[model samples]
Target: MVGASIANFTEIRGYIKGRAVLGKSATEIFKDVVDIYGKGWMSYRTVCRWAKKFASGRVSIENDTKTGRKVSISTKLAEARIQELLLEDARYTVRELAKLTGVSSSTVHFILKKQLKVRKITARWIPHLLTVEQKRSRVQCARKILKMAQKIEKNNFPDLVMGDETWIYFENYEPHRKISNKVWATKAAKRPCIAKRTMSVRKMLYAIFFTARGLAIQVPVPKGRGITGKFYRDVVLKKLDKYFGKIQPKSGMRHIKLLHDNAPVHKAAIVTDFLSGKHVTVLQHPPYSPDLSRCDFFLFPRLKKILAGRKYSKRPSVGSAIYQCLISIPTKDYIRAFQMWLKRLKI
Candidate 1:
């Protein structure tokens, strides 16, 4: 089959050379080939490329030797050096690595995959690059949470209400999301400009209190005022009281646990006093570990995806869009988020 393919390629080249000798243009020859063999046999670009080569008085029909002395970049010593350089700085691009090592980009890529066995990867965007102490703190916190969760699951799993706040930009939305309709068109057709613009200054601080069941309350913090402890207590706590009644924990279980990050407002004396006064159990969440937060991992991300490409002229509009998205989330999603939260605790 390989020999047959080679023979066919040679025949095609000879035919193209003959046509070029006859003073036929590349486009004319391409059209002729399409008429004779059909478009499926070869692409228009490939036919035109050969026609150009033949017109240049080239005699050889066979391809030039693609394999040479196996690139020196693949040598054991060179491979080892490449690996060392990559270890020193993982962010180096193929061109950068090639420049440093005096090798072609393709050769560098060959060394990376076939010899060094390493490939470039994107890092997840985290709020902070955690320090050793912070990582250790996360582990400890996870262990404690796991233990507490196991104990609670022995009877009935307590109602888990995870709360968090996020800034919602009225105009700014996720960049990669496809906002416009796509269609099949010619390569020459101008693509629609669905590119996103720079974020506008208008934004709102949106907060949510939700359980595995569904969203309980959503609060849009008034503009010009940040979430002070007093504000958090007044807005969130008041909403909490109204939802589950002044007695706390609603109707189902013995207790309700609140999960939130260690923001200053969350740890303020007023916040602590309010929780104590209301008899609400605040779950111990480690600092700077948004990965462990339900809102960070699941709720906020879903909200962002839904909000992406949507435009809002006013703060109320943004709030309304967010509310609609929150309410639209399936109960299974909320349940899954809590389940994943527990699994992450084990990790």
Candidate 2:
């Protein structure tokens, strides 16, 4: 066995020689070495090979001369080629970039980070693409709501009823894994896979309504019944009545401000008239703006994170888990979300 001092000193010298030095953590350095080399090389296998050479007092642990690897990617022409490859496919992995450019992964990375100054990030999933008019409408609607919230200032804040529907699957989908952006790390080595049942007919539509104070109610929408205007008027109305019987005007707030997305059922004429009769004011919501929706941005993710990896065989068990998770959220969180909603309107 070699001494720790000798191993450390040799590793430093090796780094300078190849311009890609890796230390022994068995994991990070192994990844670093793999990034410098292409994916054709084994991470641990190569690390162990270098360790053996270092033990025998070899000065350079890298397989080849630095000049040989650097020549392909260091020139102005090579930089242009690398940029063209990236422009064609922004999602290309570092290993893929190296393979396509016919250069070492470290070289591809150098041209990308040091030269290009561009980093790859995951794009957020949106419901649908918004048009220029839809974006203008969103900003206009936000302004109207902000004015409404302020105009009625006597009540500390009006009672805001925000509701949304989401399907709760019996088997949770594994979260999208992130690709490693390390100089040498590959996606194949870093992705996580959890064992879960793939097929299950069991699922439920959960309709949740909340106020800044806390959850008003979490209703399980009747099985086999799609959310229609009739359902909102008859079924959803009854549920709301159970909690807030006969909407009454409070100090400075003569009506409860209801906020919901632009779903077909919610926009139906019958539903609008029904809410009007009940004196529940529907706040203007921009189409496809889940970022503006409190439930979409906050409640759903919080509940789903707690439910991740939790297996439930029956409806009651799933309901219980959801209830516990929702109630456990601090009241301050809801207040903060409301504050943020107001802030987003100005932007």
Candidate 3:
């Protein structure tokens, strides 16, 4: 075999030109070159093109340089530019950044990801945009909860009952339809279609209370009636009180420590007076801080996920489904949720 060091484009093209002058066909010339050099030394089409070029009185064997835009390589300047662009507007896409920075999309992506060590992510939705005072209040409340949790015995954690109110829709559409409805299919098979359905306007306001043990009570407000301070105090708290009496007959509602969000109805004078009179200690909860609530973070999200993509014709059916979903949750999950709540408070 010919050594690679002795093999050059000029030398190979000259050999092809000489063979063409000797009346040798392109195919015969290519096979002779392969036998001398190697199997992949030159392709038959390349030999044929060179033979035609020699016949047309072409002398130079060197390849001509083509003219176009030079490929952009990742550099420190490009990385810095991408970082600056991201700082100016994080929403800038790879294509937009490429156009702005005078680089290809792949180059911009490489600099952003590999050099800058950054990744794009969707923004998380929070309950509210809190003011300075609200932020400070949340910190204070979190610290207080952390201290309380440290003092409480592990067994007595069940005494801390967390409750909240949310509207349960009769038909809850999946948040991500494309992902949830995805199915396995062959490449030739047509994609399946699903009819788009919006969230139902028909919903019932439900106040749910639970502890580390399990669900205590879930009260659905009557149709055409909204939650008022009087209703919450008389109806919601009354049922909770009854449940407590049935479970802890000796201690009644005295040992209960309620943790609920700071809705106007919950903070009303009537509700405050009722709780104070009943000796049910309401834990301190900062306004607009749903992240700290177990119901918001754990229970409601899981419940909604299970109920998503299901349609109910009647309100009673929805209520029954919710009941089943709630009870069906394993007891270990409730315990883990409470543990997570304490961990979050510490954070």
Candidate 2 residue-wise lDDT, 12-116, digit = tens? 446433432333544555566566654534446655565556545666553465553343325556678878987897888999988876777887788888778
The TM-scores of all predictions, comma-separated, are 0.65, 0.61, 0.69
Candidate 3 lDDT score at position 96:
93
Worst 10 residues of 1 by lDDT: 246-255
| lDDT, residue 161, model 1 | 85
Model 3 earns a TM-score of 0.69
After superposition, which runs of candidate 2 have C-alpha atoms over 4 Å from their true positions? 1-116, 119-127, 151-156, 170-199, 246-254, 309-313
lDDT sort, best first: 3, 1, 2
**Candidate achieving higher TM-score, 1 or 3:** 3
Predicted candidate 3: what Cα RMSD to the true structure? 9.2
Separate clash counts for every candidate: 0, 1, 0
Candidate structures ordered by TM-score, highest first: 3, 1, 2
Q: For model 1, what is the error of residue 206's alpha carbon versus the real structure, in angstroms, after optimal superposition?
A: 2.2
Estimate, for each residue in 1-347, the C-alpha lDDT of model 3 and write its tens digit.
35553456568898999888878888989998888777776788999999988877887777767865543454667777888888889999999998888888988887787668888899997658999998898889888777777555467485788999988888777463357678899999998876564544788889998877788899999999999999999999999999999989998888588999888999999999999998988889988877779998889988888898788989789889989999999888888888887777776
Model 1 spans with C-alpha error above 4 angstroms: 1-74, 84-110, 122-125, 151-157, 169-201, 246-254, 308-321
